[model samples]
Target: MNRRGFMKLMGSGAGLAAGSAIMGSTLVQNAMAAAPRRGGTIKLAWVDAVDTLDPHFTASLGSVKILNNIFNGLLKVAYDGKKVSFVPDLAETWEMPDDKTHVFTLRRGVKFHNGDPCDAAAVKWSLDRVKDPAVSSPHAWKFETLAGIDIVDESTIRMRFSKPYAFLPVALTGSTGRAGTIVSKRAVEQHGKAFGRNPVGTGPFKFAGWRENESITLERNPDYFEPGLPYLDGVKILLIKEPTAAVAAMMSGQVYGMSLSPFQFIPQLKANKNLKVYGEVEGNYSFVGMNNRRAPFDDPMMRKAVAAAIDRNTIVKQGYFGEAIPAYSCISPPMTGFYDKNIGNSGRGQRFDLKKAMEYRKQSKYQGEVNPVYIVAQGFTGSGGSGTRNSQLLLPMLEKIGIKPKIELLDRAVWTKRRNGGDFDMYDEAWIADLDPDETIYPEWHSGKPWNFVGYSNKEFDKLLSEAQDTLNQATRKKLYD
Candidate 1:
């Protein structure tokens, strides 16, 4: 979804299954002292509704969280108790002959749930499908630099790019690693449009059944390639949309795990000794954005005024229940090498001052009545209420500074549509599992790009981003982003 903006996510594994799904494996990892037991059904409570099943098209974290169990990617995030590194998933090994070329050796015997061979031809078809214009996949941007794909052998393929792309390696495992998570070509052609609902992938668990607004089920693949993985015989994913009901389900032991847990309930969830909270740090963030090409916000001073009006610290304390750090920049702290650690204290950060905001507003060209048209969405599971609540808190803040704002709450689908179409003045946006700064800045901030609902355009920014993507060295890339 490019920079869907940033929402403080609960945990980030090198590569995690759904928020709750990854932790469900903890019970087995804990039992590893003796020998991990296999065969059980793990019940997961997901707070968001999932409409799309195909990885390449869906941007919902709720879908990604569950789909993580049902799809396999070319690469995945792995940790060695010390640091996170890229590890093989569908690809047993890969080689980089040059910055623009990659050679991948696919693991044989891997088969999609549909009994289709997941070979080099399938991989080529899958990647090409995502890039196809007819597909209109939101993730198509991830492959924009691709020059061509050549199947060298039955098990090998060489990918040549027109330019150096630093995001490719991590793009495979991005968020749920959708772009590189190969899909079944035969199944796609057979199911056509419904393929998303009836997806076929080479994952440990195969999609079993799903009910509208009820549950999604997955059964263990009897012929799983990873050997004894998917310890649980089946997974039952219940769609509990409300935060209150989801929490109640968790406290009542109705479900074995939960994903996208609301911040307000974190304290109670952590207090229970029977439950475990997996809050690993990942590079995810939540942000509020404005349509730069639209009225009022089109003025830089007006934008600065709005920025000064909202207190980031208060948002962290009240909105996140003190479970999150106030984000000063879009690039989160966990991204280390490129993150501007001192940006908060660099005499410029998210500010809160009615007086300054008023001054900036006074200097702006818009002398007419300010229209604080707020756009919020039912996105982020347990946190679906996130945008609505933030709207209530923010509208008042704007009103105090002589601005009148109204809430226009939209369903996730409509909200995404309207926002991406550049139809709003101000809106709540978020991005998750952003492995690199380029992934965070380039797509969403660049002029006229998808996810750039803000409609911000600056030749300088676009140029810098172009150089950053090609500059191979971390130090130089950081400088460019800076």
Candidate 2:
């Protein structure tokens, strides 16, 4: 597909990118990235570099390394053709009482890639390690309900929680969380730093080699419990930085598939008929986070006005090729288990209400322009860089609703640092697939939480979250949330 065709499928182009679009150069890079023969080789690009090798200490992208090959959880929920099924991977079977805790019968004769036997003792150790403050896992939120893990026997493991969590089974599949995945206690103590590179799991694939920022290779395990599986003999994950190149590779059939941010490459995907595109409307949501600790954003009325002024539907349709849904609350409605839909008006769509936004602005008693600054990655998929294209599309839309956004484009590294440090008027941000509302709200909206990037403090929200967590009645729990 051509560049214009790709953009049309994805919506309109903004700023300098619109006038001087280079379809040819983009196609060339795309071909180069995807070009490679397939047999035992599979070229996949990581969205970001791997952060750590150890699953317990996994604080970065390296968790992907552990996910595919090194670790095997108690159960496997495969998403095939939009349906989910529980398959045997680690745990053979499980039982739940009132949905608060899961008692799993561990699989027998499982071995870590390092040759350590995976047992109840090992499972206990692995779960405990996840809670270790030293790890400071990025997903520490997932463990909030984890009361403790009780080992019933050599082959039995029961995990009791602080309360009932409907998403428990789905949560286990998450990059974070201590579910049925059993790590070898012997391995962590033996090889701490080196273990990430050299690891073992009961999965069909085994560790082959990892060339940092280049590629990570793996080969099928001959002794894998499910023999004759992993259809491919081996796979290679290339670390390509650009999304355009990744798309090009996919179109050329250089690689089977690659993880791409939908905003940047959806159009190209729609244009390629030969290629298959698999996308899920993830429970993740992105919103304009204003630094509440900073200027006018500190004003509640201003925050409310900004929230009201945003026309989510227009942005969703134009920017995301109808692939995205406009969000009003921290959690999208699709994943709102027992939560009340009326708690907040999440139906806000893409309709500019300049008069309303200005009314709220006037109420806040803000000064001239209320020119909020927005930070985004400069690159198309944004490597650690700077540019105004992202802002160009957003600023005008915000202005149409009576908000003038002063753009502050920065390199990815600086942007990330500032965002995590809570130092901007507003920013473009999103969560990947957080299948639960607790996963969406607790860390993000709760006061004093690290992931609360906007510094939004709400005691009422916290109290509701606490109430929801302990309540056994699904209706009552959702009522508390609402």
Candidate 3:
């Protein structure tokens, strides 16, 4: 089947199943009808502990999710059941004077947890901090086009870009987007290195306490700009790295919910009448990332050979257990306008043909003893098992085409360091794309960007990406990407 058709079928089935599950749960239906309950704390479990609360320094999903509750950006991305839309957050309204300049009218009377006013200066300060060399934020690439910030007045600020950037507003929407979250300059200056542990923001939640490797707590911001909101009194986030322990916690009512549960436990969880299993096809995919900087992979023919030998069906079945769809393009399916469905139709790539794999292998120049390609996997979360299973299944396929691979399981920190540093020949990993296509495509493919660890660079690809970012016409952008 075509990539588009396959994705549609998978998404529709998953959506229907999720709908049925929700409808069948009497507790969920009754809770939806009741008035917003207040003065109650909800405990949520995560597989990893938040490394930092500073949105600029956040690199993990756990950190980003927690920071979303304690921070506010100038704009926000609101995801309904069907689609995503950008909305005003700290800024009441905004306008574009030209293609390169955006003016925002700051909401008045919004104060930080430290009582600092949220105004034009604060916005400028927050953005400048992310760009500062000393801060060394992982998200600095998001602001590469930023030229300057002009404070028109106390309640207004104009952001100027070197060129037209259509995704700038979208990028500033949430913690998952760019590093546009506003922070209190006073609080950050006072706390310095300790600011992450003592976060201060203008969101629904305020940092209450954090016990290292145990839990992080946040209380409702009584003076939140949105009045009569944040119905929950507080939230307690427990760091439970073990999947079994997390499931046990949910069963025992120790935690109200889990951010992510293992797929293997989904059946048991769904069978329990007291619990609900929610499912959605996430805008993400797993892959065995080949380091193009190294030998063999540096050649396009060898890369094609490797791609043709492996079966995506086996990977999805063995690694994800039917939870994932086969990815064709680097961009995931959910992101509209960017994903090139035609790429999957090409017969030369992502098509498992042992004959073509053998032909390409024979055409390659590196006939000498090739070292076993190292595939690194993290030891925590379901990804660990997925990576292990993927490597095991991939071994025989590669062996059939005259290649060898070794799997290495490491802790999260070590795995991240090696992956970011390009120290491995291959790595089993996943990319969680932002709401915008530019955010997903740019950093990973733009030659000099730090996240492009694979070191795959092409002048033509770079030109198309630049033009796509500068052009306002969606058709033109799609053409360039395609």
Candidate 4:
């Protein structure tokens, strides 16, 4: 097919992306919405599967986004994805008394969904529970710098860091994947391992029920700390895995709002007059993380071959349809001060070259005799008249370098299980809502870290990253990262 023909096909196949866009039709139009409509149920859908509601355990981006709505942290990130800024949530007011100590005054009368007091004690317990090894919080690494929590009074608590950690406030945000989202101590201890299923929090919404593989129902917190808020009686999030099916539901008005709408549907959705679409440059990055412990990929030459074969510029223009920026560095373009414009050229990073990829493949252990590895994408199929457009972009490029792939569009839970167990080869996925440069790369690439899904470990890289995190000076940190 011609390039235009190929891009046209790919656009229709845009698959799962976390917090991609929210589209609303009749579901959002309220005549009295001007006067604050109070009783309408906002129906929304998620294209990815959600296994757990417990914020601390599941690393799934879908679950995290859902949890963000049902829970509140001491602070919150700027709602718009334009910049990184911290705003208060559960904490009514807070002050950093020193470089290492953070003092917070809790809002009185705040209560969990179960009517339990969400006080300073609860905050301390929640933070302590995350750090507790017995809890096995997957996000524990985000709080490694936490020294201890000291409850000053019934409505006040102080948190101390071991060092001058500038990322502390950002990490404590109420956004997805953040460490500061506080849960009720009573609810957690009462439910134990089942707490994930029955989540209790002090937010606008409360977990009503989950139908597993179908939908999650949330009801408004009648006694929410924020007065006259939430604006809706409840929210119902449908779990629709297929992209086109979701688009059909949205167009038919079966669902009022939808997130992770396939990029291919953007043009079509925009053409509809009744719907309003809100989009932002996602605070995330998608990638195919290889299981480096396995053969073929274990050889650096084969890995370099995989990296050099694909044209990133075309992927952004044709595959993403100009909806995304071509990212060479993990820190995306919106992060102005840290993002480097000089990194994406022939002299520095890997450039698209089929010849270079073939040459690298010839020098590898497999030497062009490697078995076709499985490239698993979550929540969508490749060629079966359904799935993500990612295959349209990646498949032919890899073929040029003689790395033919068998694409598997597995269910989200199964896909996550395989990747976490090292039972998969290459997983197509993204880590979203991340802000810090350290958080984005360190957890996923650092040696033996909780999120090092690829089992990659380089001592020098680790050292440099550590220095970057420790060095307070921005210029010095950039130099260390370089």
lDDT against the true structure, per candidate, is: 0.70, 0.57, 0.71, 0.68
Give the TM-score (vs. native) of candidate 4.
0.85
Q: Which ranges of candidate 1 are over 4 A from the true structure?
A: 1-35, 80-84, 353-355, 378-384
For model 4, how does the per-residue alpha-carbon lDDT over 1-482 read when each residue is reduced to its tens digit? 32122112212111101111111111121122236556878777677556688887776667877898788898876746444567778888989787788899988989899998989888999888888888888788878888899999989999988886766666677645456788888888899999999999888999999987688999988999787788888989888877788778888888887766666677887777767676656545555666778776777677777766767667666656655655544555444446555655524334566787788789887865455555565544221111256555788888877787777777655776787887766666665535667767678777788888777766655666666676666676555544
Where does candidate 1 clash, by residue pair? 4-430, 5-430, 5-431, 6-285, 6-286, 6-287, 6-430, 7-285, 7-286
Over 4 Å off in model 4, which ranges?
Answer: 1-36, 79-82, 333-337, 341-350, 362-365, 381-388
In terms of lDDT, which candidate is stronger, 2 or 3?
3
Candidate 3, superposed: residue stretches over 4 Å from native: 1-35, 80-82, 340-349, 382-385
Tell me, what's the RMSD of every candidate? 6.1, 8.8, 6.2, 7.1
| lDDT per residue (tens digit) for residues 1-482 in model 3 | 22233223222211000000000011110112246667888888776446789888775666887888999999997777555667889999989889999999999999998888998999999998887878888788888889999999999999999999867866687586748999889989999989999999999999999998788999999999998979999999888877788788877777878776665566677677777776666655555667878776776666666766777766766666666656654455556556554645654225567898788788888774455566555545534235566677888888888888767877878888888888888777655545666776677657777677778676655666677788877676655555
User: What's model 2's TM-score?
Assistant: 0.78
Q: Which ten residues in a row have the lowest lDDT in candidate 3?
A: 15-24
In model 3, the Cα lDDT at residue 185 comes to 96
TM-score of each: 0.88, 0.78, 0.88, 0.85
Over the stretch 1-482, how does candidate 2's per-residue lDDT look in tens digits?
22122112112110001111101001112223355443465566555446555554443432554465657766655656443445555777788865678888877887776677777777777767666678565555666678888889998888888777655664465243323355667766777767667665567778788887677788877667765566667878776666566666777777766655435565666566675555555444455667878677777667656655656655555555465555544435445353234533543221245576667677776745667777775552421111243355566655654568777767767888888887778787645344455655666666776577877765555666665555656566454544
Estimate the lDDT of model 2: 0.57
Stretches > 4 Å off in candidate 2: 1-39, 47-50, 53-69, 78-89, 96-101, 161-167, 174-181, 191-199, 261-273, 333-352, 380-390, 400-403
Return the clash pairs for model 4, or none. 11-264
Write out the backbone clash pairs for model 3: none
Error of 3 at 202 (Å): 1.2
